[model samples]
Target chain A: MEVDRTDGRTPNQLRPLACSRRILHRAHGSASWSQGDTKVLVAVYGPKAGTKKNENPEKACIEVVWKPKTGQIGKPEREFEMILKRTLQSICVLTVNPNTTTSVIVQVVHDDGALLPCAINAACAALVDAGIPMKHLAVAIFCCLAESGYVILDPTKLEEQKMKAFVYLVFPNSILSVLPEVSSTMKGEPMEHGIITSVTHGAMSENDYFLCLERGRAASAKLSDFLRRSLQSKVPGDSSKAG
Target chain B: MLMEAKPSTSPATFVDKIVVPGDVVLDLSTFTNETIKLGGGLRQDRDAISVMKAGKLKFSKPNKYWVESSQRRYVPCMEETVLGIVVDCKADNFLVDIKGPAIAFLPVLAFEGGTRRNIPKFEVGALVYVRVVKANPGMNPELSCTDAYGKAGEFGLLKDGYMFETSTGLSRMLLSSPTCPLLEELGKQLSFEIAVGLNGRVWVNADSPSTVVVVSNAIMNSESLSGVQQKIMVEKLLQRIK
Candidate 1:
């Protein structure tokens, strides 16, 4: 059975995604990512001198500051910041810049739906723009589970309010490794199928949550391809005499 | 018998190609006898070498590989010449900001022919050309104003000039061999003294402040322009300056 979204999107169709890097001038790295009506602007600074107190000084630290479109930061914003920080920490090569603290400041331009996923995407792009060392790039996607047992890839604000549950899932980018026949799979699943972070809202059965994860993982591959293409297309000075 | 197994994937295929983090770039199983030096963005993961940043894979002959990318922030590396702004002057060292993760310490005695009695006085916020001596993790990098032989070889303070920041890639382009077209075109008409630091800082000086401004702006604008575009842009700027 096909699920019809309010925006006329099919169950598997995601909202259009747009990303631009190096958008902020003064920041070491910056990017703005938007999905449909939701947009997030991220500025990356530091690997600065030292980590914050309580943070282990032996390894690099990640600090995320979330600014909503309006109002002061509340419980939800704090949760978003924590989730974003941990998600970024996992993908980044923290040991490469030990004792340094990289700050990722996320400013919510708009939050129609899937706000956390958009912010995560923006932060990941900003980190890449800043040239921070990372083990891999991460792709975040939002999945909505309707009461009818159908899952939707990306939802709008109206759809989100009507959904029974929603989940934000982050996955490592599916890499096209140059190695000839080396398997990139773990057990029976591809490595990129492993979830880096998952945030759920409302109540859902274990089976429903796994369904959402499967749908979200499938959508993330497309997002990762777009990310890789955009990054490669705009390499600085590709045609210059620097080569 | 293992040496007879020729690897199908060669590192040469990815040279000058774009690679992102987690992309396996080199299969080390092929080169049993040869040793390869890995640079900034490439890391060894078991027998597979992978990239840790998004950039072009650059290979220099004999066996050196690295990832090159343009960015505002610089990760400090050893023996790199950089222009640093002194943030604070302590009794024995000066804290300098080289656009790196932390402030580097330029020892008071690291200068040429330096002695405890003749320590150079550098005011806070002074710009000096220095070389990174040590860049170990978990420690503030150390800087020296003198070269390896303890001589002040163009390593000192600038009397008067205009200093500007650029992407590290642009500064590298300015210092590339066969002098980039933009610099060549500017030099044909104008005379300017320029110092390029690997940490994305450039200093230019000319007889007139106007020339300094022109040279700096030209260099900054030429970062995204092609070689021919750079030549054309310089011509246009020189015309405007006149």
Candidate 2:
């Protein structure tokens, strides 16, 4: 299943992205995000103490609710929730908001495919909007190998069907922080290894696995840049020091 | 010591010296000198003395000057009538975005006096007439839809309507318009109070029965005025009715 990714973009190229904070008036923090045609609105509430007895008391509990258009909770929504919860928990400094729950609610008003990764990005933006303390912002990128052996980055719905496997690239801050520091000082060191998190190959060959990992790393790096820029504009001031 | 009397050219100068405790005198001889020498004070240049007068001059207390600018006051404040939306409702209050400088809190207790189904009766996106019971800086604005008139009485209440975005200054103009005859013709004019929050939230509500109609008409006709200008006109109009 060969897929011709739009714009002749390589498997490492990310889609155009836009993010806005305080998109809604009621929520503590709200953000609207769009990656290609996948648009999602995420609202973050709390750091307010949770009511349920099982709610965590030592660290902030993250609950993600994904709503798709015209249906109840489905498999795709659940999968995105799990992935987003895991990815976000790793980056967020939950201890800062102890005994409270930070809920990330993502409403997929429009789905043009590739919803999970979009939801993850939207949730990250919402968390930032809510002013949550995080060690680093988490960014997710999707990659897949086409039937023709070409890997695609940020696959659309139509392209997803033609792919054998999809990988979600999760990049932490070390990769970005190291790139600028190393490029200026070292002569031979590779500028790419800083990608701390990459989930690839639910099913794929060893060769394809490595290829997907490389693609994931490259794509995640690009998304990290995009997320930084997006968060910068919404926060009204330099948020780099937030970490 | 007697000082030369100065002619009043600028109102500010006359008022400024009036506040000082002294008998201000004017001398014609100082006019030719381009400078005046005072008995108990330093010699002042010609520009400092506006004019010269003769004889013993009597000084009086300076009148307080009230500087009025074109700016309208419409930010949301406590106990002021306001128009807002139910962006979100909590157990005790609703978050309202007033068209002024900040968000104001309208507690459920503020509405307790009015006839409404119950607390938290409003839903998201519902527009209602509310009063600003409290406002905190950099905090979520709370609003109360229930007032003496009840849940935005038929004419006074606005559930679904077009929200015209304009500056707080302009909204004041529309509300303060003195020349607007519609208010007087309607009779029993509405009493309204406005609070312009520092966060750019504007809250307006009318206490009189005719307030809704008059406000709507004034706002509708205010399309020609810009935001700040409209507020001025409205403020003037509202003042005349009161």
Candidate 3:
């Protein structure tokens, strides 16, 4: 089956993105994001001591809370918590800030189709707002292979349910150094792994698998650009400041 | 270090009106050879005079033009009382919803120095008076509910006043009249406070009897203050020579 992808968007096209940091007051760091009609607000608290005995350790711990549209929590929220914790841990340099905890609270004030990936982006923005150090940003993207042979990038809710399989990818970007300048730092080699973390759910054909990766990579690049721009705008004096 | 220069553009447009990734329509007849400045509205493309793509715009409006755009920051100043509800409590601090991007925290220590036990005794949902102490860009704002006269003691609570939603611009315009004698006539001082949060929540408490009457009339009429109407109403309210 063929899908009509209108709006002149490529199979891996991302919606127009707008992000503003320090959007909320009480939290240590906060950001508000909008992609098309999907809007999400994320607040980051802590680096403070964790109250959970078991979870508290010498290293910083990450906590994710998802508040849905109905203003209630459910299975989806639980799953998001797990996914976010795992994804954030991969990029967060927790060892650097021991005994501190980073809490990421995501509120989906509005929903369109691609919420999970949007939430992930918002979370990353919040993390930056919170001033937490990270090896790299864990950018995410959603892709699906429709029943008909079309590969969809950043699939909306309706498109997701109609697809045969879905994939979520969280990756990082880093500058590779040509040589090891210090004994502590690893030198040379493809230095920048910029490894892509992908999770595929449901069954799909081999062709769909390759297509999903291809679309995922393209979407990731677009999101990375947006993340960079958002961070740049919030920095102390990059000229975006209002005099 | 290489610094990126901001492009020289004319000011005749509002930032919100500029469409992203879209073209703009310009009228060259009104355009001059010299660089024109655009504030918060539209601009014309010089080349074609007839059409121009939207130009790069600033995110927030400058303070000179207090137009209540979504991107403006909320700041509190002296003598301007604010109305806010306590949303959360943390030891000596109370998180009050002042209708901004972040809840403004009121420290119990800012209150009048007293020996009252149970120091920071403020309950959730309790409305209180607060004055903006300092609004630091990189730090959470500091607020005090007490002023020289007293601890905002009872002046902050709203007993018989009406509550309604309005924009920040309208609220600012209403409060611009510092000494509204009309408000004092009804046996109440024009010593009311209001908070216009960025999140669209408006909290107001008017102590002036005439001011209360004006507020009631505005609410009953479902009238929003803007342009001429707002100016006229504010002028009339400040005309009381008592």
Candidate 4:
């Protein structure tokens, strides 16, 4: 087995995580989350009155503004914003804040391999901090298919560049442990884990994609555990109790 | 939907209930000649008064209804005093970013007893305490440095203070009647000068910078806390500082 992973971890291991909520005093809700060396700060504003231009009066609207680590916003940041907006819009209970706009401003402090997933996690944490109602919490993990067909979970930026294909997968908080038969949701049966959004950066076969999905979903339990513990700690007087 | 006659909502009951857009707040037909005025966060749709935003529904005495919420962006409203930072200085107006959607305009001659030769020169990035004079839709909000009697009235440049931004709700809480318990407690223990603007900007100054930091941190930590919680929190903070 070729041990090429930097920061010295197994293929499925995640980096050390530290996230703090309400870091920005001015924002309605804010959080700074870092996975390994990759860090992102997210500030959520609004749940206020009215939307920006092309206003939608029916359901709540979400706008994501992504600012890169350096340089002005360009096409890549715009694409990230679109992807994040869609993922957050799915999890957030929009009908709760109708005709209002909640803007999530994400500033990239550092970009390792899993930048998007970290941004999504930070945004979700910020939304929760803002007291926004969400159907379920979402967590993202980046999976890479190495040249040797080994799937690496939560790859760093350097690891991603060395990969054959990279897949970014997001999954809503779900019950762990789906049976092997149920794991392959070929019959449209409601599986324990549902993919909220999936984006592949390089070419990979359908089998490889599904393999990456399986590995990514299994590794998500650790991320979910981190989120639950962090959120519980933030809520005062609700000190970590059995859930 | 047919406009069936429904009982008007009690203003007292709706004072603090969170409301969403399109929620029919009051059925005007049942009011029966009793005049009621709608405030911000509400709009008239046909015979029913509906909410236009998501916030706690607020109602004042003598028939006034509005929604109250703490948001990052400040919607310009007439007569509200705000602290603004000058973004640019033009011949006629100074562009100020009051954390509003549109940049507010502070006219050069809007100061008290102003004349052509006496126009106050404010450098870019200067912080000024001003009142919203005009907030027409599709136009920039106009700001002034004078009160109703054309006096400066404690509205002017704030200097040598640590200015920090908070949510509009937190700032409102700091300025509420009877004073916020946190501010009251801080004032009792420490001698410091503080200014809270409706635009959510706060300036704190003291003989020592440490006091300013402690006061600002105490206030920021008290945003989601209750009155009693704020007092307890401030006590703990003060204890740590000592």
RMSD of each: 3.5, 19.9, 13.6, 10.4
Selected candidate, larger DockQ, 3 vs 4: 4
Model 2 regions lying over 4 Å from their true place? A1-3, A6-8, A51-53, A173-202, A234-243, B1-242
- What local distance difference test score does each model get? 0.88, 0.54, 0.56, 0.78
Model 4: reference contacts kept, as a fraction: 0.03
Candidate 1 local Cα displacement, residue A202, angstroms = 2.3
Off by over 4 Å in 4: A1-243, B1-13
| Model 2: how far residue B4 lies from native, Å | 60
Task: Encode model 4's per-residue lDDT on A114-211: one tens digit a residue.
Answer: 89999998998788666565656788998999988888888888888889889889987642211233432436744326889998977899999999
Query: How accurate locally is residue A33 in candidate 4, as Cα lDDT from 0 to 100?
Result: 80
i-RMSD of model 3 (Å, 1 decimal): 16.3
Q: Which scores higher on lDDT, 1 or 3? A: 1
TM per candidate, chain B: 0.94, 0.43, 0.48, 0.93
TM-score of each: 0.95, 0.48, 0.47, 0.57
Off by over 4 Å in 1: A235-243, B1-8
DockQ of candidate 3 relative to the true structure: 0.02
Residues A1-243, model 1: lDDT tens digits = 977777888898888888888878899998888888898999999878888999989899999999888989999999999999999999998898899999999999998998999999889988988999999999999998888888998788988888888889999998757666545567768778989998888899999998888788888889988888767865432211100
Residue B215 lDDT, candidate 1, scale 0-100 = 90
Q: Model 1's chain B TM-score? A: 0.94
Q: Looking at model 2 chain B, which ten-residue stretch has the lowest summed lDDT?
A: B49-58
**How good is the docking of model 4, as DockQ?**
0.04
Instruction: Evaluate every candidate with DockQ and list the scores.
Output: 0.73, 0.02, 0.02, 0.04
Instruction: Report the C-alpha lDDT of model 1 over B18-120, residue by residue, as the tens digit.
Output: 8888888888876789989999888888888888889889999889999988889888899999999999999999999999988899999998889999988
Among these predictions, the greatest TM-score belongs to: 1
| lDDT of the structure predicted as candidate 1 | 0.88
